[model samples]
Target: MKQLNKILLFTVLLGTIYACSTKKDTVISRNYHALTSHFNILFNGEEAFKKGIEGINQGYKDDWFQQLPIEPIVFDDRKIVAPTFKNNSLGAGFGSKKEKTTTTQPAGPFEKAEEKAVKAIQKHGMNINGLERNRKIDDAYLLLGKARYYSQRFVPAVEAFNYVIANYPNANLIAETKIWRAKANIRMDNEEFAIETMKLLLVVTDTLEADLPNDIKEQANTALAMAYVKSDSLQKAKKHLILATRTQENKAQAARNMFVLGQMYANENKKDSAAAVFNKLANFKKAPYKYKIHANIELAKNVVNDSISSSVLSRLEKLIKDRDNRPYLDQLYYQVASLHEKNDSIALAVDYYNRSLRAKNGGDKQKSFTYENLGNLYFKNSEYQFASSYYDSVLNVSTDSLALRIRRVKRKYKNLASLINFENVVATNDSIIRIASLPKNEQESYFKNYIENLKKQDEEAAQLRLNQIAFGANSSSLQTNSKGEWYFYNSQVVSFGKTEFQKIWGKRKLEDNWRWSANASINTRNTDSVNVSKINTRYDLASYLETIPTDKQKIDTLKIDRNQALYELGLIYKEQFKNENLAIRRLERVLSLNPKAELVLPINWHLYQIYNKNGNLEKSNTHKNVILSEYPNTVFAQIIKNPENKIENKEVVNEVEKTYKKLYYLYKKGEFKNVLVNVNDVLPTINNSKLKPKFELLKAYAIGKYLDKETYQRALEFVAINYGSTEEGKKAKEILKQLTKE
Candidate 1:
């Protein structure tokens, strides 16, 4: 009886397994496969798809300065790979694993979702007698499309979306599939097609407005707005963004849309409208903290001086004191600084700018703006060194997208660098020359004092070394016991042995002559000999005195260089820095040095301008008469004769322009060598004219076209260094950057 029962149980199990086969065209087989696919495989697939979406959203960082995309898909243009379907379902957990441990294995929740989706189709799909019976196949396809979309495989994602749209037209996910299709189109740079499809989706949804879900309506509207934004139709985008925000399904996106709408109004110069929109966002209770904070900043920016109330300042102060807003202090401080600047409270503005820089978590963009603002402020005050320092900070923090602004800052900083360099040279040389003019006894006394200071430093350094060695020896002793007597077992003893050996043998390498002094001598000869020679020279007072410049011709040449640098610095302070007092001091020094005849006219003219601007009529007349009597044929004399002769200067500019036009035409005609010769011939004649930069730039271009790369680089470098403030010079710098990058 037991044997019979076992046989019967085995037979019943076999029959049940046969009845569940998906190939059978029966009620039981179809329902069984459908239930298994929907409740088991497809259920897990949908969950994986949702997790993938969460991962994407959590990883994406929105740049609030730019308009936000409807979806948070981060696309990588270099990662275009064809989608391959896996047969095994074991890899379905790929999307759920947050931490990836291996590079060789496939990862990401989206890839897992795709694997589960493929498994469902392959293992449980039932198609019998030319008819498909699986009910959850459409859901599987929907999941597949979304997984591909999030994975940044747009072409494959489109194929999946198209499959669902073509094969499952009456499915519940058809509308969503269409929306996904349009999004994929936009990512593929098919904005026109996306726009058309979204418009059609909108019309269909409008007809079924009562039946369609609110989230669907919101998605459609937001997709249309993104499409319009891509096409640069901000007005049209604003309308759709308004509709999308009204749905309130996605609070973060709604806040972003409202902010972009306000920005659009600001861009169009609708100050009142922009203020109203930003104020509405600021009052929104559920908006993200970032959006609300930035809205308040926009409101502050739009505040007109005539209408600014006490409440405005009070509101900003209250925000600054709020502990919860600490993470956003960088932007808040910058906004406050801008407000003070607008009110002409320069001291307060500078304080706030410094506060912004001191904030712990400031974004690079905000820090760059703060640095640039400080640079501009100091530059306007004629503090070129301080301004250059601030501008350097700006460049260090600025991003590559700020190319034009970076160019302008670099040009200004380069000019300031030149002025600073020449000023330092003049000051240093003047001090040296003054010391050199002293009597021999005084010079000896100065050298003696300097040598004494050096001796003191050497003594202090020797004492420090002795203290460090003592500390190291004590530490080594503490780290050992009686075992320290063994050189190989004790680290300190081994170290001491090595050092003593080196002191006697002088770094003898392991070789046949292990103890011969001459064998070790080769190792120490080069470095030790030089160091000993330098130490001997440094300690000898006579050697130190001999190092001072004493040749008459060399001293005279240095004096000339000093006077030239001083004269250039004076002109820079007057014209570039607009600091008349500093210019007067430098130019007066040049006059005292007995500057050359060529420099006297310009220096006197500059002094005249400076004195005239300061209302010193007597001093201005003195310089003006000198220029007129001594250099009557120069441009300075002509300028003094008729200060208001605009027509004459205009005519001179017109002639230069004509020359530039002719040379530029020749350049365009491929006469590269001729262009170079003509530009050089015309440059010296227009040394002080405004057209010199244009002529020099033409020459640079000609050199680049006809000469070797090294020569071209040198020519561009010359323009960048000497004529950096001009537009042509900026172009030269940009080209040089490209060449270097290549």
Candidate 2:
């Protein structure tokens, strides 16, 4: 009887297991699939989707200087495709080195969620009489769409979203799915489609009184703003961004929207409105630290009155002193520097700029701005050397987006380089000439002093080496045992062994006959030999005297070059830099040097203009009369006598243009030599005219066409240096750069 009862229980268990099969549509089957899909598969999928979102948010770094995207999804401008799967079986002990390796073997969380969603739909989805009976199937589809969207598979994501909107119209997640589709469209550069779909969604939500969730409304509004932004309609974008900011679903996104709205207002020159918007963001307690800090800085920037400026400075100082704001010191110091500059406190501004450079966690962009500001200040002060150094720092830290500004800075730096080089040459030559004029005994004394300083430096270096060796020896003795077996581990012992071995055997290589001094000498033939007992000529008094230039022709040539450089620097300061004081100083120095007759007229003309601009009428008239009376036939005097000569000069420029056209025609007709001859003849006549660069560039082109590479390069370099400010000069520089690469 017990065996029969056990058999009945076993039979009942089998029947219950059979009734749980998903093939049937009874209550047990329906509940089993529904429960399994919702609780088991869909639950894990939803968790994975949430974790995927968290991962994306953690990885994304927003550039707050630009408008922020509404979502955290990182869309690559490059095309993305689904990864192809390959199952290659390697031989027993062999694998291809070309095989790719990744840290994470499986897909990311979103991809995992997508897989699970597909699995649930394939395994547990209930389709009865052309309807999905399992309600969780719609959720699985929504999860799939979201996963695909986050994974940047926009086309697939759109397809998934479209499937839901077409087949599951009455589902609770339909509105969200439509919003997702619109966002995906935007990602795919379908802004118009996205805008239309979002508008329809808004109409439907209002017409049906559906009462969509706040997050959905925020998303729709942000999407519309993004669409308008893509279309370059900032006014429309501002309206929607404001609407999105009010929804308060995503606080970070709300802060971003508000920030963009303020930037738009500022762009439209609505300073007060922009300041008001930024103030709202700055005062918001829960905004991200970045947004809050930048908003505050923006507000400070808008402070126009002295009273408001004082308050802003105090606030910025307080921020700088706060320990908790240490990470933001770079930006705070930059703002303080800007404020000081606005107040014309140049020294304080420079100090703050240096402080910003020293701050920790300051981005390259911020450092670039600081360097640029310092460069501008020094440039304004006519400190071209210091300005060039600062500009170099800017270039090191600046991005390609500032290409135009960087090119301008680089051009200015080139001019500065010329000035600095010529200034250094003049100063060095003057010092040398002065020293050369001293008596032989005094010159010997100077050489002796220089040699003494060199000897002292060498002695100090030798002492440092001895101290280092002694320290190493002492430390090694303490660490090593008395046994010679541990000698190899001691650095001092190793060094001593090497030195002693070298002294005895002379330098040798690790090869046969290394002990033979003759063989060693032959082996070390390529190595440099240091002979301590040998006297260097650089330290000898006679060699020093020999280096002082004594030839009268060489001295005169140097004076000529120096005067020419001074004259060029004067013109550069006058025309390029617009520093009249510096130009006046340089021109006066040129006159003191007794410049050539050709430079005197131009120098006088520049000084006259400088004095005129500075309101020194007496000095201006004095120089003007000198040019008019002494060099009346020159272009300088012609321009001063009648300003109408400028229009006549344009006619002269037209004649030069005709000459250039004739030479260009010769170049095209394969008469390259004639082109060169004509260009050379016309260039000197137009040397004082703006057409000089044009003529020189034509000559360079003709050279490139008719001459060897060296001649061509020389011609191009001449054009680049002499006419650096012209378009033709820029083209020459670019061509030279391309040739150098080849």
| Every candidate's lDDT | 0.76, 0.77
Report the lDDT tens digits of candidate 2 across residue range 1-742. 9999999999988867865564567786677778888899989989999998888778888775555665655678576664332443211111233464333433788988887787677677666666677777788888888888887887777777887787788888888888889888888888999999998887777578677788888888998998888888888899999889886788888888888888888777787888889889988888887888888888776775788789879988987888988888888999999999999999999999999999999988889889989999998887888998998888888786457777887777777887788777777767777777788889889888986687567546655665565456656654453334455656655576567555444566788844333344443334586523323454456778778777888777778877877876776777677788888998999887888775676678778988988899999999999989996765567668766421223347677778778888888899989888887566545546777787788888988996899778767866665565568877987898799899
| Cα lDDT of model 1 by residue, 1-742, tens digit | 9999999999988877976776776777677777888888888878878887777777888675555565556688778665564443223222222333344433877878877776676666665664456777667777887887888887777877886677667778788888888887887778789889888777865676436677887788888888888888778888898888887787877888888888888878787888888888999899988889888878877775545634556677789999988887888888888888878889999999999999988899889889999999898887878999999998888886457888898888888888888878887888778778888889889988986788578656655554555456556653554354333555564466566545433565688944433344442467546522122445456776776688888778879889988877786777677788888999998898887664676678778988998999999999999989987865567668977422233338788889899999999999999999988677656766887888887898999997998778767866764555467767987898799898
Candidate 2: the clashing residue pairs are none
Instruction: Return the top candidate by lDDT.
Output: 2
Instruction: Indicate which candidate wins on TM-score.
Output: 2
Give stretches of model 1 more than 4 Å off.
Answer: 1-35, 64-70, 78-106, 126-135, 208-211, 266-279, 293-327, 361-365, 399-402, 430-560, 577-585, 608-620, 633-742
Each candidate structure's TM-score, on Cα atoms with residue i matched to residue i, is 0.68, 0.74
Clashes of each: 2, 0
Q: In candidate 2, which residue ranges exceed 4 Å CA deviation?
A: 1-30, 80-105, 300-302, 399-402, 438-546, 612-615, 632-742
